[model samples]
Target: MASDPEDRAAAQRELASLKFAQAQDKAKQDPAAAEKLVRESLTLAPGDEKAVDLLGRVIHAQGRLDEAIQVLGEGDGKSCDMCKRYLSVLLLERAGKREAAKDFEGARTDYSRATELIPDATTALAVARSSEQLGDLEGMTRAIEKAVPLIRPEDTAAQTEFLGFRERTVLAAAGRGDVATCDRWLNFFPPGAGGDGWYVLQLRVAQELYRQKKVDVAVTRARTMLGSTHTDTLPANRKTEFQRFLADIYRLQGVGYLREGKLAEADDNFRLAMEFLPGDDKIKLLRALAIGGHHETEKALQVVKALPKETKGHAEVMAILESMQVADRLAEGDVEGPRPRSRAQAASAETPEVHVAMAEILFITPAAGVNKGIVRQLKKSGIVKYPNDEVNRYGEALSELAWAREQARGLGEGYLFRGPGIDARMANLDRQLRAFTRSRSSSTPTARRS
Candidate 1:
């Protein structure tokens, strides 16, 4: 019997296979009996992958997870597919038990091993969740990435579960101000997977970007979300809040540009802000300041003058208007005075009729300066009879008209400044100036003509 080692080895292998078959049959009915049989098989054929896998499963069924993991892990899982599959299952069971005991590191390690063996969505997601529990966001992200593509499209429940997990990760990342992690997880969220929580996360990211002085990136992100269909479907109040946030970003950008002396850029940003917050008086004031920075004092004055009377009365608004007026005078080379005449001085100096008549002369005349006819008209109106200082006279007429307009506005819409009134004439002048400005900036001949 001992003469031929080859025959003896074959007989032992046959016995081992028989024992393993019996172990498989009894594994569900009596794990204890199954474990005994699998052990016999492994002893007969040492290192047999099938016998090892069966032993691990029976041990696991008896709730000896650590022992089962050790038995299965001793086999060559890399070379034997059956061994790898069995080891993965046992590892998952052990990981869940570890998680229950608050052994997060052990659980993550076990889950990771299972995922490496199986590489399926279930195991991968398990690893992700375990990694999350351990506060290993980078590990969690990597696990989720692996799980996503492995999920079958028909398995909608799994997809939904994964999305929920991803959303949680995103919010968690945002809560800790982990911008890169937050953005990565957010990208993993499928369209429509992002509910209100998704928008909240996006807003948080945008706010963080703004705080970091990454204004352009923040603006782009917020603007894109604002225009998204998801945002359009939000509750009205929520949409308005989002819009206000974007408007604030734009306003801040405008202020930055103003400080840097980038007048055109500042004006453009404020205009965009107004689109979001059309009734924001503060933003409107900022736009006027930007225009004044461009040396377009009259245009800036027009914007300030058109504000609600209450806003016009604000000290800040008055200061801005006075600064623009002073800049206008300096541009006209009127540097003789220590300060421009105050609104009180202008109001005390002129009657309402005289101010209105002067406004009419300035409105009708060409930009080259007041001609002889216009001077006579102004003289008849009791302003600048000589017209030697045409620039100062024009500026004085504007200031007077501005003061008269404020007075008339205070008295209500029905109280006119005088014949033909300041309202109609001012409106006409604004329209003409706006048209002219547009003509100079645009390439279209029709726009220039209009």
Candidate 2:
């Protein structure tokens, strides 16, 4: 124990150095003990760089990462190469452990902390990886962006690998519908330097610019993405994601044209979407709407005919086609009102004189789907008397036997019907009415209305 002030200060440094040396030996076999010893050394000599480095390393080796970083921070404001290197390596090991244990957020914290010590490519990649695992796509993207510049341009492999990671970040953002964020990553490379994702990003940007009412710019941006001068010419069957991205761009720009009352341009864009994604109901529906909006009801009807059967949207398409046909007739200046649609109105609908006409119309109507659902509901509610209502009603027994004959003749149920589905019962009723009418007229007899 020294007595004088200068002597005491000198002794403190010497004793702290000695304790730090002991801590180093303890670190290999017993990190907890080494951490305690290093802490005491730092307490005696608060700015001892070796003690700071040893404490961080020992605690980290003991799996106490957060505390290790805190200990490492002790000499952060001062220049000490050993402490910096130890902090960097300690953070990387901690991040690796967290990532392996599937603790993404913890790994992200460690990786990001490592970058603060040194902007190393390996650590930066780890940061991006952890961010991706955490579903922090924007964070992943920013991490890649910040780290890429740190890579020397001559290191082509590192640059190319970083570019691949950047593409992945862009793809993840696309999957989550984070289109606007994709633009921030564009400045990192020259135009088209990052691969096909750059075009995908441009498409999303066009969508947003269109949304914000930048019409000319939006159209220009969207057209540029398609590699076309005309808005109608979009790339087709490009990679799956590229096609989808292009289709989405067309849909937005098409709708924008539609809303602007530019029917021709709208048709062009909608058709381009169709070329990229054939048999897309939503796109087809939009096409029909555009044609109807242009007063081309016949063309619109043809578009509706292409919709897939037994789907809700298909049913809606049927309704739209019927509406267009009605509107087309109305445009021809007819005085007649549209037909009535209820059971009370069934005299005109169900009369034998109108049986075939009514059945044909009902078979093609969109309301048929709704009625099918109602039939299911009726069954579920235990309301229908029997599934054999066909054999008990007037003229029903005759129709059933007639269908048996028709079946023997290889006419199969509804084989001659002119509608969507084949219902054996409805086919029999139509056949019975037609046969009765032919016999009555040919035999010179006055038959019951049918």
Candidate 3:
């Protein structure tokens, strides 16, 4: 649209007003207001590069990212190359067109051209990320090749940004399942390079090794990183990431123990897994372990209660907790006298089903009294059939115990039983006790001799 003289002067006044409004909007963190001002500025001077840039930023900040890209593209060739590079990345990333459109490579070209126009380390890092994304390993190597030479050794920003580029290159290599390339990148890390990046990279390497089934190597690498005295020096975000990695390690360790039938060790690892995961994730693990009679069910519930109501798994945990509470009230009714729980009591009954469940989960030991009677019966009779099957019998009994424990954890009526399982030794002892009492009362000579 062509502008008349008066129309052009009025447009200038509107542009000036919006410039003031933009500052006010930013100060208030009012994205809506900022967007409105930028849009009005663009309307007043439709082809104004500054107006387009400001509007594009406001739109991107508001997450109307596609619209931002369209607005920014108007100034794509005219704006400073640095601005174009940033805008291109936002466009490519928000469009989810990274590899599909080969935009990362285009971004690399822009950054490379920018360096020819103005040499800078930030541009070098951008080029490195772009090359890594494009699977141009040698290009990545070359992009950062200039970085170290350009950087003064003591330049913290350059060093930090270079480390960032190196870390990303490692991640890209790992993503491509190119462990050899990742190792080559690791060689560049300085000997004393202790930071958020080092521990994270170590954990990533360990994870890759674990994925390759190099279990012992993975364990050693994880422990070495975790046990480092400087772990405390890591940033909060990095420490959270480290804790998540530890949780994953513990989960794998738990699976190993569980497969070997080592219930105690499995339970320990799973409990540690819950401790490091977020509340929602922790509850899921707790529910699974609670069904298996791990001892941390009650503690897990307490932790879930502490989470914000908006947490992802909150509703599910609350439902399970409510069902458990009802079951507890039902079980306690006969033992604690005929009393109905009040609504408030029902809601917050911290009853101890999980505690009792844990106590009862252990293998039931045949006490001395029971064993003595069984041995006596075995010695006296032709009733001991299939004597070689004792170990098999014990295993069957333990399996039954495991099933009962699973049921008693309130796994619903599907697992609950109508009757107690048969205990062969106890049954034999009962039968022999009845026969011995009858003989003793009849003045049997065997009882008198004893």
Where does candidate 1 have its weakest 10-residue lDDT segment? 413-422
> Which has the higher TM-score value, candidate number 1 or candidate number 3?
1
Task: Please give, for residues 254-352, the per-residue lDDT of candidate 3 as tens digits.
Answer: 655543446577667778777777543643533443433333335645765666767553544444343344334444553344322232134322322
The residue pairs found clashing in candidate 2 are none
Task: List lDDT for all candidates, in order.
Answer: 0.67, 0.60, 0.55
In candidate 1, which residue ranges exceed 4 Å CA deviation?
1-30, 45-50, 152-183, 189-200, 223-246, 253-268, 275-282, 289-450
Listing every candidate in turn, what is its Cα RMSD in Å to the true structure after a full C-alpha superposition? 15.3, 15.1, 21.1
Off by over 4 Å in 3: 1-134, 142-146, 153-164, 186-194, 201-217, 229-232, 236-244, 259-450
TM-score of every candidate relative to the true structure: 0.56, 0.43, 0.33
Indicate the residue-level lDDT of 193 in model 3: 44
lDDT of 3 at 86: 53
lDDT of 2 by residue, 118-199 (tens): 8876677778888888777778877877777677757676676676776665555545545565556665773225445555
lDDT of 3: 0.55
Ranking by lDDT: 1, 2, 3
